[model samples]
Target: MRKHTGKSVSRRLVLKAAAVGGTALAMPAIVSRSVLASSGEINIMMWSDYLPDPFRDAFTKKTGIKINFTGIGSNDDILNKMKATNGQGFDLISPTLNRSLLWEPLGLIQPFDMKKIPIDKVNPAMAKMGETVWNFGGKGVAWVPHIWGTEGVSWRTDKFKPAGEFPSYGDIWDDANAGKTMGRGHSVMLGAGLALERKGEMAPGSMWAAYQSPEKMTEVWSKLTEYCIGKKKNLKLLWNDADTQKNGLLNEGVIVAQTWDGPPIALKTAGEPVMYRAPVEGAMAWVDGLALPVGVKNVDQVYAFIEACYDAALAGEAIKTHGYNSPVTGADKFAGDVYAKNFADAYPGDALAKLNPWPPEAPWYAEKRTEFVNKFMSA
Candidate 1:
């Protein structure tokens, strides 16, 4: 009944983890003057509404430190700026789970002191994310798990018809659905790779590692090439953000499209004909965690900031406000029934009942993304 509405945020795709240069480095200088140049002020880079007034107000009230926050475009942007500063200015950075693998090794990150964090306050699920994304094999020990969510089919019910068996990634290739479906760019390509996995064709250590083999890679590539290049004409829309995916379905650009849970959940609450459906085969899931950049001067301040957010009460509020799943396990007890019902709609009933959290596995992505891009995108 209560729908979430806010301005659409820019989606940043990190093509590569390149060092910042003249213009890139200068951008943060401008932000510093406008945001964190005051005494006892800390600048934070994160997604919009991720840290609401409650948390900031609570933190400031509790710690006597001013919170100066800036909404960044993407994880890559966050990393680029932190790298440029050599981890000098910004106190905290929130980046996607997989991408953290890249940042951790660059000396951009360092481990946080567990003594500062009340381990009991954190949700077990989030702790797992922290271990996998930021602390992958003790690589970048500085980051902590924040809010997390996934990519899947967020559809407009009035415009599109989903039948008996819920659609899977393989459905994207169906000719009958041509020009009536949309897909997310970059990240959803990982979903496309998963589709390849469903067909028993994919390589080891690829995005489809859950369903791949070294022997089947060649056959998988041949098949994937046909779908992406040969069937490119059938795609009604290729979107990069949640707004575009929702708009495409509403505007008739596509009937069913891959999306995160937020947009469709918003539309449904507004009494619009829309739904968020995660495929039966499994959806491409992503998790994001908060990390302290290496070389932070105010390590105690950073720890205090993380500790405040780690409080289950604040984390629950963030999960509700953002419409993303909380990696914090017990936070669910604080959520409304509508949030649970709506969130559950995205998954198949059976699978939803026993959801298996997606693991943060980077070596799999690093090794395989190139071949997939070359075979699917190029073709």
Candidate 2:
């Protein structure tokens, strides 16, 4: 069994590399907790790997905060779980940075009490993302960075080669790779929109502009959905989480797929023939951050648990054992050198500049996009 490492590359290096890729990183959110953990109990709903068993156990022993944890797989899973309970069950919830905009309308989250958190230890850029993007009503913050990564292309090295100077999202739909590729449903649609935009089929910036309004989203997505439907034969299967991605490339005969950076990189580090990389159109970068559910019951305990999460050393140690990139400053020093190398290997020359940060979306647009995804999946 292989474990994913975290905070491996310094944020400065990553931000610089992204600069070289010809794009800027913004609107990202991902964070963790602190070492001055108060004693108590807290319920956590986050990605399964976010709290590796070792970290959870160590946190339990050190802080004496008996944690009741429920791990979720995707932002959709996070949304559904919160909605299913009306935000009453979990104390700490993790959702991707780009997805933060949807929570306010659902009335599911409360603004994070920054004074209760160790915000000073977090990565400056990630903290700014939360401060600006997660601020609801211009007064309170609703999310903080925990873990950040990207969604991009991966391939079976023995089976395929990029057609140009760099891999583009377009490669996923090319006839040659058809029947051998995969992607998450909604993101693949976004990738399609991007490819279409580049080909002059859709207006420039149409993909990001779809986030602004339902009318715009509908117009942009309509074309994207149709193009994706036409390319349906290209995918072997659409993966929803890390396991499916690994299995698709490792066992299900998939040669290429749009994937979170972690999965394929994990495989490659383990000596598999797979390779993951940023695409020419850009690697979709995002951060999964911690948020407070509105009805959080154990308020004090929640703060304690949150503070424990921000402890840079613990966060870095967790990364050494799981698949995540921390937003906690000083955590990278603990993730070992391999992660930095992996970062370099994946972004190879200007791939970082191509980072296509996932833009914020309206709750309505999110719902509408889900419908489009379902339509494409069923078509």
Candidate 3:
């Protein structure tokens, strides 16, 4: 059986590589924990293969705080699980930066206790992005930046050759690649759809408007739905999980697919002739981070888990095992020479400047996108 790794790439390097900067302030006070029974464990809801096993084991050994992981496949899955449990099942939740914003309005998450987190050790650029973007008008922080990466095309290097530079998201529509390509069945698909719109491959409009206005969302989804239906026959699969996508590429003869940067890197390291591309339109950039769910029972253990994530040694293992870059400063020192070189080559800093980061979308927008996706898949 083949092993499949999960999503995320480093946003810290991308921020530095792009030379972007902004100011941010730390959390003023730690939320007072209400008395509750000690569980001696920190429950984390995150994507599969996100936290390396070695790191989890080491964290437990070092701190005596057991890490209970509930692996999820997508951001929507995270939200669904949280809703099902009324945000009570987990202490720490990981969601993409944009999804984290939605949790605040839903009353599902609470602000981090800055005193417990090593805020000074986090990447300043990421801190700024979180404060300015995810923090709902500076009211309070509900999300803390952790790991990030780009969403782009991954192809079998042994099978397909780009004419020159890497192709655009429109490549998924190529007739010749029919029955050999796959697309993710999630809102990130909207990122690629919007990129196609930008390149004039689909109807033109403000992609952001789809997230803000019902009329505009209908307009965008109408175009997106039509475009997807046209190419549906070309797709070998519509994947909902990383392992399925990884196995499709490795053993099922899939030639190209939309993917997070991690899978291809893992495949390449394993000697598969695969490559992840930065499409001409732009890679869909994303940041997934830690958030405290409301009514968490083990508050101190939660802080221990957060600090363990930032431990340079553990951060290094995450990069080596998961193909993601840690947002914690100096974690790269532990990523080792070979993986570091591979990461530098795979995601050059200048190329990162071309990445289009995922922004917060309205709940209605997400609802409409899911509706269209279900329809497209069933069709």
Candidate 4:
């Protein structure tokens, strides 16, 4: 057997290894952890608001494990940073529940020993991923839900009001909002597909079936991309992160957008006329959680961190900080009436059941989707 003499965990090398019979899975032995152990800090790549100073301080005070935190705005940021480093440096990542299954196959993440993490403390509804998508070959679960949220419509009530109880995703693409609307590129395409689905344009269940095969994915997404491109003239900006989403609505002359549940909700609480809700087409829901990276030096500290995150009180307190919901059971009780009211307002009626979950991505699906996303962005 020829040995991999180099120290780098670059994506090229890992994927190359995986192509030749899953040699990529043997990551624990390839990367040295002596360098990581000397630092003695748990390197975490997670959402910016997820690790507020108080949360970090409390966790550090309790476990004596300091966090070397790197904040990310999107899941793509998580993928990019990890790819740039070949999955090295960071001990933990928070891939979305739907995206978690792709990591182990790429040899980027290790699985969780379920017994070590407090999975039982998490809400059964949110924790189900640990038994399905996150589970790798029935051996170990790769990711666990920490915080969960939806992607839907947000609009400046004073600036614009569509004629509906719950505005449809179609409103964002309408000529009335042209040059005054915005959305994240690849994602809004998904929203547009849902809109098409509801309108009897795209086949029902086709969007979810995109994950089943390469042809199905391209067939579904290509139509969505075309529809989005036709409406491209209507967009004021394409936001990539939460800050950009808020800024576009508040300052960039954007009145309506398809957005994550967090930013617009926070703005509303702060007395902005902004409001976010489940669109008539349905909001896209997803879970973001901690996933261990391969070649972790501080495995014990990683497990400790996971255990601390399962604390319901702390998780609930984080709701106001990020404007997103917690997956920890009983978290809402600690979040107060305001959080309760906000959640109610966002999903008024059967919208919760109508949430279109982001399905797990197959590697080829990701590869081919990028081609369309780039085409739409440049178009």
Candidate 5:
């Protein structure tokens, strides 16, 4: 064997190295305290609103470790960056459920040290999702549950009313609601497809799932595509994120569109007559979390960061700031009257109980993204 000495290598080599290195499982080497101190920050790759000012400020005030927040792009962008970096010089990443499966298998991320961040501290439902999803189909550890929420239909009570007491997923395809409705670009179709399948109908996971198949995923996709195309005349907009969907319903009067719980909760709190319903067939729920990458330099600091996030007060701040329910135990107590009042006044009875579990691990989504996107999402 020849000694290897190169400052840079090809990207393909980086990926191959990660796979060969078991996703950079073991740390390369610990840098000296002086070297780490000279670098002066804990780098983070996460979603927007993940680490709000209060959480960031509280952490910095407690420890002098500055946060160099980067990677605010799409999930693919962040995962590709982590893959390219080969587990070096980053502390944490909070990828969605789908991305975790890919990263963990390649050993791009490290197994979460439960002792450093006790798994019991998180919400039980979220904890279960994390255990199954991040734990690599029961063998590997990759992503952890950072945030979780459901995708469902949201409607403006101020503008319209359907014929029935409760709205169903099939309401989107109804002609009576025509031109007053919207589905979330392709996510609407995918989520609806999931809802349909959970209720014994078939549609692909994404509109693109039509091209790739176990046949089931494509069956779901095709149904959703037909539903959307048929209802295209009824749509006002195809939404992407929570805020846009909320504003579209509130300001634009797009009465019914697929959305998560956060916006409807916020709008209702602000005295808007908005409602997020968990259709009889159930809704699609998602869970995300924090994990140390393979190359993270400061294990101690990374552990501290995880613990800080799990802290009840910090977790409460994250909940208030981000609007997702916290995974941290006892965060409800720290939630204060604002959270309590809003939460209590927000949903209908059994709303929390009605929200269902999202499928834990799905490898095919990332492995087949191009096919899924092309068939379903593309206009």
Candidate 6:
């Protein structure tokens, strides 16, 4: 299994490793004696590079709260760790909206205490979306919107050319790109499955509805699995991490693959002829946010950390470093000209409006999705 801040591994392998307590799970870094002795330390489990170091330092300087960071490779890592500890290990976690649907119901995380943070500073639309997804069963607010991004197609313009306006998910099936394409081996597969259905290449099915009923799920996965089997020979890889996807495009000569917006933007910034496309079928937009785990020990520090994340300076720094959009309303004002311009260009006004957030899924959805992903991977 892959470590979040390190190498790449398949999602199926990682989940299995996590189940039996694999050593790949990141251990907490040693806290300085001064910070440990202080009453301001907050433990956080999140994607390794999601939060920039300068921002963490600035937050500590501003609030006197030290952040203990533990990075994980996938949402499954977050869920597995929380379950192993019975939600007692970390004070804060960053999970996507869909994964939180599973975590909240299991009592692994508690809802946000609105009064503790400056909720008004966040973008209203983004905040509302977070609330709808996190606040399950009217159980208090589960999380606050932090960073948002899209899952779409990233291709090497120097290697691949589309026959039409721009490439869509269908490019994965193009024979011209045989033995040079990749697909993510997780929930993003669900998004690509839906995209194929929308393009009329596959039979009609609701990717969203598959979450609610076993019958619908079986129907959807049957078509998706068959599609994968047909396309299997063309696929050179099935990636489970951003680094593998980026490296494949940059050095391994992969013509095209499903990817997050950040890597291609980074590659382009570094002079690679890579492009991230909001496909004609629509990009899958997602929000990852801060949430408290059950039995949290540092309430005051947790609130301080949450408040610090909303700071305009921190938000701007996040945008500059990771190519993610901040949910704070005015953070763009603090962003450097180049990054701001790049963000605007990547998500033009019309394109941004067309971005679709992943719909809420039932708890059973993740397990079923994983089962199909494992099947697709083995096929």
Candidate 3 lDDT, tens digit per residue, 1-379? 1111111244444755422310121111232232122236888888786876777766565556688898887888888888888888888888887665466578777777776677677777777666666576566777777786677878898898765466556666678888888878754357557668767776654565676788888887787788778778888877776787789899887888888888777777677898877776667777788888886988888877776676666666677777766777776776666566556555544556676666666677778778888888888
**What lDDT score is found at residue 142 in candidate 4?**
78
Candidate 5, residue 379: the lDDT equals 47
What's the distance in Å from true for residue 10, model 2?
A: 7.2
**Candidate 4: stretches off by over 4 Å:** 1-40
TM-scores of the candidates are 0.73, 0.86, 0.85, 0.85, 0.73, 0.82
| 217 Cα displacement, candidate 5 (Å) | 2.1
Error of 6 at 140 (Å): 2.2
In model 3, residue pairs whose N, Cα or C atoms come closer than 3 Å (at least 3 residues apart or on different chains), thus clashing, are 9-148, 9-149
lDDT tens readout by residue for model 6, 1-379: 2121111112122222212210111111333333333456889998766766777766676557788999775788888898889998798999876565577668888887797678898866567655676787887888887876777777888888755444577677667788898877764466567668777766654666676687888888887877777777887877666677788897786898878777777677667798776666666777778888987998878876676677666676666666666777666665566565555445443454455667666677777877888887787
The alpha-carbon root-mean-square deviation between model 2 and the true structure, to one decimal in Å, is: 6.4
State the weakest 10-residue window (summed lDDT) of model 5.
Answer: 19-28
Q: In candidate 1, what are the lDDT values of residues 21-111, reduced to their tens digit?
A: 0001011111222123223757788865466566677567556678788776455568678878887677777887657556656777777
Model 5 lDDT tens row, 334-367: 5545555555433335444444444333467545
Ordering by lDDT: 2, 4, 3, 6, 5, 1
State the lDDT at 355 in candidate 6. 58
Give candidate 5's whole-model lDDT.
Answer: 0.59
Local distance difference test scores for all models = 0.58, 0.76, 0.70, 0.75, 0.59, 0.68
Taking all chains together, the TM-score of candidate 3 against the true structure is 0.85
* Model 5 regions lying over 4 Å from their true place: 1-39, 71-74, 87-89, 98-100, 124-133, 136-141, 162-165, 194-213, 250-253, 270-273, 341-347, 350-353, 365-372
Best candidate according to lDDT: 2
